[model samples]
Target: MTQKDAPTGADATIPGKLPATGHQGRQEPAAMTSTPTTTRTSTRAPLAAHGTGRVPPRSGAVLAGLCAAVLALSGCGGQKGGSPAAGSVPDGWGTLATSGVSVSYPKAGSGSGGYTVQTAGERSKYNAAAAERTEHGVTVSLITIQLGFTRADTAEDAAIAAEAGIQLGSTIRSTRKVKLAGTGDARRIDFEFGSTGEDRTPPKGTRIEGVILTGLDSKDRTFAVRVDARKGTLPDADLKRIVDSIEVH
Candidate 1:
């Protein structure tokens, strides 16, 4: 039997895990100072003493101390914020969380269509995926949401990096800066696209609206959240709610 190409959009099955390949936050060595040591050696020194001081402590004890020191240095300077998400999950909504981030969405109902929560990762598309949900596929509604940690140093850098993913005919609508917890930096992007004639879902020529909100998480890790939907599939009110619901640890 011949294998079939998976349809694009929500029809694609998500892989079980996303390897975190994004740039990890770097830590500078803490300012350290050491007093110089002057050793005076005696040709016939006693076995209990080295050149000048008592025999060095056991290697195991020294190694344990050094390990603790390294961990202390590497663990400091962690910036924490954006936890306890901005708002409560909407009534009957679901949440997806991973890779230190979380997001909420509408739950499937008795009806055929509703929002979903997922961990979205496409190595070809994202640096580090956390939570994501693309509304529907297979001849149903249309919408997509994604949260990904980026490899950029700043929100501005990540925003520019994101532009590389725009489809051929898409048009950028607007871009703006946002604040997080009153101290963080963020960016919100809006755009539109005319679908290319493709065999997958969403049909051909559908007008799609897109919004991407990106920022540095509490720990200074870069993150990007995206939503794309057929012009009217998702309401603005619900959109704001979702964005407000993000929390990065």
Candidate 2:
């Protein structure tokens, strides 16, 4: 038998099968090969190392905390209202010894409780020293001491003579006698005076209030201590304390 060519087109059939036009005997489509797919996932690190994921504090807040810590460590923020301890001497006090006198003085500087001592000179017959305390360019308190040897009958007599000479252009406010420790009878005089220039007329707004104390030691030495304040600046108690602390050797 001659092999017949497979039928052409949709009518072709296998040799052993009967010829059929319906699509029942066609070879099934080749099995499809599936490609495997892989999924990739990514992870990110936390914002902070502490792992709590919180942002850092602001710079200003950090600086303020540091300052507060420093202040606390320095111990400088406790007292609100307080006073100096009783029976305690003021700070910055020092001793001044010159020309046979030794005394306690506040700090040393111009307008800050300093003093200058001068011994007897050709123009003056006494040893003198002056201490001054000032505020805002104005003298608030001044202490002046003069020491000399005199041949007067008594300390009071010598002080009166000295006062007469010193009060030439000054107004005497009052005079009295006061007793001092380790000294004989003493004379105290209060005065008010105005500053003068070559014209010999008192200057305006330059009135000074002064107190003078003169007495003699056991060896008949005449000593005088004067204190001057700008019209009401000196406290009586403080002045008394300063004068009482004077020591003349």
Candidate 3:
């Protein structure tokens, strides 16, 4: 794909080192992280309150102080475990919502190949989900949609941070800010990535492409919609349609 904006990785840079990237949104690549340290120590440090310069409340703020150890795959939140995405996905076109955030896509065998799904969990900002369409052993869809929560201060940072998953050795192409339906302060990052072909899927040295769209919902928590596929899988029209279907309630 041609570079529409300009080469920049400012989007993947987390604020003072939060999570790096679930599939990178790069779990926040199912794990790839850098520079973000989330420890499960006491609340005295208040990692969340560091940037705000505001004193943490005396009580009931314990949840606010701890950093979500999402990318690391370390259970470090309110201690809640995870669950499979709720609701049986339809075989045709369908829509699924988690923690009030939603995205629409063609379900597995619905068209455009076979798609599988993952949903949100009970924990806020900890749940992550994705919709994938694959055929045989190779990825057929141009955009595999992934949705997850972030604790960033704004959508600007979160969107920039969702770079990708299993995208070995990804390089930045361009990044630009744009508006999307039902989302606030959205940003888009386009990049080129590589595949190690470890599972003999794409073969060695296969070229992979990815995009990350981070935006804000009503509660100020950030959400990520990331897509990746073999280069030139489809046009931008279908991608736009899938992205426009996203809604954070």
| Candidate 3 stretches greater than 4 Å from native | 1-92, 118-127, 140-150, 163-168
Q: Which structure is stronger by TM-score: 2 or 3?
A: 3
Residue by residue across 1-249, what tens digits does model 2's lDDT show? Answer: 001111211121111010110000001112321112211111211111001111222244444543232110010111112221212224555444445343455554623344333222310222244444545443444454455533344544544433443322345544444444444345555555443211111233455565555556455666665555555555555554454555544
lDDT per residue as tens, model 1, 72-160: 11111112322322434677677655464555666666133455433223222332332222343432222222233335555555444
Query: How many clashes (backbone atoms < 3 Å, residues ≥3 apart in a chain or on different chains) does model 2 have?
Result: 0
- Please list all clashing residue pairs in model 1, or write none if there are none: 135-143
* TM-score, model 1 to reference: 0.55
- Backbone clashes, each candidate: 1, 0, 14
Q: Which structure is stronger by lDDT: 1 or 2?
A: 1
RMSD of each: 20.2, 53.5, 14.6
lDDT of 2: 0.36
Q: Which stretches of candidate 2 lie over 4 Å from their true place?
A: 1-92, 95-105, 108-126, 135-140, 197-205
How do these models rank on TM-score, best leading?
1, 3, 2
